[model samples]
Target: MSYYDEIEIEDMTFDPKLQIYHYPCPCGDRFEISIGDMRDGEGVGVCPSCSLMIQKRGEASNSSCGYLNAGYFSSTISSATRDLIKTKQARHI
Candidate 1:
């Protein structure tokens, strides 16, 4: 079975401003990703550690199922955003 088979995704709103797909991770962690940026059929992203392409199950539209493995940090993202992720990770542990 593929790793994608293990992920449970909900219908999520796409954000044009960020150009990414968002989903709640199985670990209770939320991740945002850019499907357009990934190699075709190879769900991959540029997040710190998690970098892979993730696809939702049984979704006809790619917009509903395709996503990068993790969220990326660009000039658009504020340092505060990174800090918040760090904080969340700390709390999760």
Candidate 2:
């Protein structure tokens, strides 16, 4: 099965400073994303168990408001694959 099959997606609010996305997973794992190296529509993020690339739905908007600045305004992931991203990031770092 494709890696995508193990992941769940959703729309959510993002914070650049904290570099985290707050959401709950199907397996009861609450997680956050790192925005340090994110592009407008796609970026690498880390979770408790996994590391993965997150794709946002819409283009990034330029607004004076801090929250409206950049990153995926609405996004989500699955708990099962969440740790995969974290593992990837650890290797890079």
Best by TM-score: 2
| CA lDDT of every candidate | 0.44, 0.39
Worst lDDT 10-window in candidate 1: 60-69
Cα distance off (Å), candidate 2, residue 45? 4.3
For residues 1-93, what per-residue lDDT tens digits would candidate 2 score against the true structure?
112122222354555546555444444554444443433333323345554333333322322123432323324445433455445445544
What lDDT does candidate 1 reach at residue 23?
63
How well does model 2 score by local distance difference test? 0.39
Position 58, candidate 1: lDDT: 31
lDDT by residue (1-93, candidate 1, tens digit) is 234332333454456466665665555554555544431344432233354335553331433233221343435557785565456445544
TM-score of each: 0.35, 0.36
